[model samples]
Target: MESIAIFVDVQNVYYTTRQAFGRRFDYNALWAKLSQSYRIDIARAYAISSTDPKQRQFHHILRGIGFNVQLKPFIQRLDGSAKGDWDVGLALDVYETANSVDRIVLISGDGDFQVLVERIQQRFNTKVTVAGVRSLTANNLIQAADDYIEIDSDLLIGQ
Candidate 1:
């Protein structure tokens, strides 16, 4: 059987939910739903590590939750700018895994992923879906996705 790959941008989901819906993310619940939909042979969460100890612990939590965690250290530019880019990592992983997977599930709300989604579908013929909360997502992103799941309800209760 062909496998599925799940790529999550954790910070993006958290900030979008906090800013738009005010609901705390239930990652376990979300993961359950995604697994139910796809074979999910590879699961990854890309995160940035700051000086804070909590960030390190969060990375562990992700590993404990059965995801391959990729950590990028937070870099501060001399021009008084902070930089952390998970998009590049996410896209590269998706591309690398696309040939092996039947489907690619991206757990993020960033509209910027539209291009990557398009490329994945056109090149690999992989079914691409953007699983995100309703009303908190970009229209263009949804349009670009081959399929979409708007997690607007209590999908956490094994529903």
Candidate 2:
């Protein structure tokens, strides 16, 4: 079986799915679907740390699904904006893991990751599969990826 590394941008996915489909992404379904075809070497879900009971419970659920839930403290700025980005960290990890894995699966619609996807594929000769909401995902990102998985009802909760 081919080795694969998975990275989930939890915040991006949550917001995009809710915005586009009014539903949550089904991680379990994604796991089951991918596992059949690939040897999952590493799975990481990046999220913002929260004290909310629901958030904690969600994190626990992700852990139960075999993901390493990485959290960064949520920052509330005085300007009324908040910050909890994992782009840099995620990019670094993916770059490092690229050589070891045959493919990298990134779950996010953020256009910022386009460069990272392109670079890793070119430098490491690794296949990059991007899974995101088609309506919300950037065109450049979709073009950069080796394969694109549209996040539809099949990948959403209660579908």
Candidate 3:
């Protein structure tokens, strides 16, 4: 079995799912399917800390389902624009753990990771899989991946 590490972008998934389907991603179902195919070495979910009780509860649930929830403080600028992203963090973690794993599964629609994906594939000879909402996923990112898993109804809650 391939040893796989999962990297999840919580903010991206939350907003994209709410925008695309008005429902949450079914993480439990995702875990079941992914764990079936690969030996999961580490599953990390990056999230911005919020005061919402429901969001906090959701994070707890993610932990129960075997994710290591990494939280960042929500930042609001003077111009009212908010800033909270985990691209660099995710990249660093993946790079640090690359040699130990055979596969890397990244869950995000952001295209900024295309280069990182390419590097991982080329340098480590690891299979890279991108999982994202189809409509929101970046074309370059998908093209760069060794495999792509669309976050369709089967991966969403309440299909």
Candidate 4:
């Protein structure tokens, strides 16, 4: 079986899916679907700590599904804007873990990762599968990835 790693941008996916489909992502279903064809060497989900009971419960649920839930401190600026992004962290993790896995499955629609994806594929010779909601995902990212998995109804937790 091929070795694989999964990196999920929790906030991006959560917001995008909620806005586009009015539902939650089904991680249980995703794990089941991916495990059949690959030996998942890494399954990490990046999230911002909100300290909400529901958010904590969701993090626990991700752990139950075999993901290493990484949390970043949520920061609210004086300007009334919030800052909590795991793009750099996620990229670093992917870069460091590249040698161990044969393929990477990045679950985010952020276009900023296009260069990183290209670099990983070119330098490490790894296959990158970009999974995101079609309408929300960046065109450059979709084109750069070795494969793209469109997020649809099947991957949603609830309607």
Candidate 5:
């Protein structure tokens, strides 16, 4: 069995799915589907920390599904802007883990990850699968991935 690593951009997926389908991404469903074929070695979900009870519950659910939920403080800017992104941290972790795993699965629609995907493929020769809402996902990111998984009804809650 090939070892695989999974990375989820929690905020990106959350917003994209809500905006595109008005539904939530089903982490449990994703885990079930992947476990059937891959030896999952590392599964991490990057998210912004919040004190909301609902957010806490969501994180707990992710943990129950076998993910190590990494949280960064949500920043509120003086200019009414907010900043909380895991691009750098996620990329670093993926680069470090790429050599050890045969495949990597990244769940996000962020175009910023295009470079990371390309680099991982070139440096580690590992297969990279990207999962994101088709209409919202960036063309460059999708093109860079070794395989692209569309976040359709099958991966959405209440579908």
Candidate 6:
């Protein structure tokens, strides 16, 4: 079987799942399922570092779960804008590794990834899958993906 690489937009999935389903995510279970389905060369989860101790612990848990935890400091702009630094990093990682990996699994509800998915598919013919809570998912993102996994109670809770 070909190897699969999972690229996760941490806060994107975290916030959306909370808003749409009102349930907590089971990261370990979800990762386990993905690993079982594929050789799983890469599992990168992107998150911004926060002063919050709990957030730090969450990051630790992700690392313990076999994911490459990419931590970028959360930059709060003077103009009251909060910057998300991972999108570009994720894109770069995807561009660099898409050809080497057989499948790319994206975890985000953000619609901006439609272009990324299209480009990867057009250029590399890599199977791209998106995992997000169904309610908040953008139609374009969903359509661009080869498969969609709605991480809900059944998925998170391992039901």
Query: What is the lDDT ranking, best to worst?
Result: 2, 5, 4, 3, 6, 1
Query: lDDT: which is higher, 1 or 2?
Result: 2
RMSD of each: 2.7, 0.8, 1.0, 0.7, 0.8, 1.7
**Candidate 6 lDDT, 25-118, residue by residue in tens:** 7888787788777898988999998889999898898899888889998888999998966888988898788999999999987899899999
**Residue pairs with backbone atoms closer than 3 Å in model 3 (clashes):** none
- Each model's C-alpha lDDT? 0.81, 0.96, 0.92, 0.95, 0.95, 0.86
Per-model TM values vs. the true structure: 0.88, 0.98, 0.96, 0.98, 0.97, 0.93
Query: Which rank order by TM-score, best down to worst?
Result: 4, 2, 5, 3, 6, 1
| Cα distance off (Å), candidate 5, residue 107 | 0.3
Model 4 — TM-score against the truth?
0.98
Candidate 5 residue-wise lDDT at 133 = 97
| Model 2: ten consecutive residues of lowest lDDT | 150-159
The sequence of per-residue lDDT tens digits that candidate 4 reaches over residues 1-159 is: 999999999999999999999999999988998999999999999999877999999999999999999999999999999899999999999988887899999999999999999999999999999999999999999999999999999999866
Model 2: per-residue lDDT, tens digit, 1-159? 989999999999999999998899999999999999999999999999999999999999999999999999999999999999999999998999999999999999999999999999999999999999999999999999999999999999974
**Pairs clashing within candidate 4:** none
**Residue 98's lDDT in candidate 2:** 95
Worst 10 residues of 6 by lDDT: 150-159
lDDT of 5 by residue, 34-73 (tens): 9999999999999999999999999999999999999999
Highest lDDT, which number?
2
Local error of candidate 4 at 9, Å?
0.3
56-148 per-residue lDDT for model 3 (tens digits)? 999899999999999998899999999998889988998887778999999998999999999988888988999999899999999999999
Flag the better candidate by lDDT, 2 or 6. 2
